[model samples]
Target: MSRTVAWTPEATETFDIIVELIETKWGFASAQKFVRTANQTILTLASHPEMFVTVKGQTIRRAFITKQTSLFYEITEQQIILLYFWDNRQEPIL
Candidate 1:
């Protein structure tokens, strides 16, 4: 069965910021492409939530939507919560 996927407020904000930057730096077409790919990945995750690798000790998982972008999420009995949309190029904060 397919699970439900929802984004946390922070993840939504990250997505908006990234999309806007992509639109400005590249074009609407590029931004649209990114959105489409990301959405499809989310939808796909619903049915195959364990398809991605775990980030570490946490139950949270990381799915690479693109070479530079990743979708961080956690799954529960209730729903799949998207934690963040991360830019992998940047060094992770400790």
Candidate 2:
């Protein structure tokens, strides 16, 4: 069964910043495409939450790269939580 998804305040802020930056650097279409791909990744994770391996015994999920950014998330029985939107050039937080 599909699980519910939720974004923490930090996650929401991170996503907004990424979208704004993408729009400023590229264009609305590019930002829109990024958002669409990110959403699809979340849905895919929710449907098959087990696809991600645990990190420090926590379910830390990483999205396949599209362009320069990567989407990271965490999943639990009650919630599929977005952890961060990371730029692939930089090291992951955790």
Candidate 3:
């Protein structure tokens, strides 16, 4: 069976920010495209959770949403819990 996908609050907020940025920078159509692409990519995890290599740790995996962003998630037996949505274009907050 395919695992369910759940987005954390942080991930949802990050997604909102990116979509808003795209809408403001490009247009609603671009933002819709971005969301559709991202959702399709995210769904790929349900059937193949191990597609992406673990980046942050042994349990966490990342899947690219766009050229500049990726979604980080952890896989359990029944679901994939989305942890964060990272935007690569921004400066590292260090």
Decreasing TM-score order of the candidates: 1, 3, 2
Name the top lDDT candidate: 1
lDDT of 3 by residue, 1-89 (tens): 68999989998999999999999999999999999998998889988999998875668888888888888899999999998888888
Question: Which 10-residue span in candidate 2 carries the lowest summed lDDT?
Answer: 52-61
- Against the reference, the lDDT scores of all candidates come to 0.90, 0.79, 0.88
* Stretches of candidate 2 exceeding 4 Å from the true structure: 55-58, 65-67
In model 3, which range of ten residues has the least summed lDDT?
85-94
- Residue pairs clashing, model 1: none
For each candidate in turn, give its C-alpha RMSD to the true structure in angstroms: 1.1, 1.9, 1.8
| Candidate 2 TM-score over all chains jointly | 0.83
The top-ranked prediction according to TM-score is: 1
* TM-score for each predicted model, relative to the true structure: 0.94, 0.83, 0.91
For model 2, give the RMSD to the true fold. 1.9
Sorted by lDDT, highest first, which candidate order results? 1, 3, 2
Tens-digit per-residue lDDT, 1-94, candidate 1: 7888888999999999888988999999999999999999999999999899887677989999999899999999868899889888889641
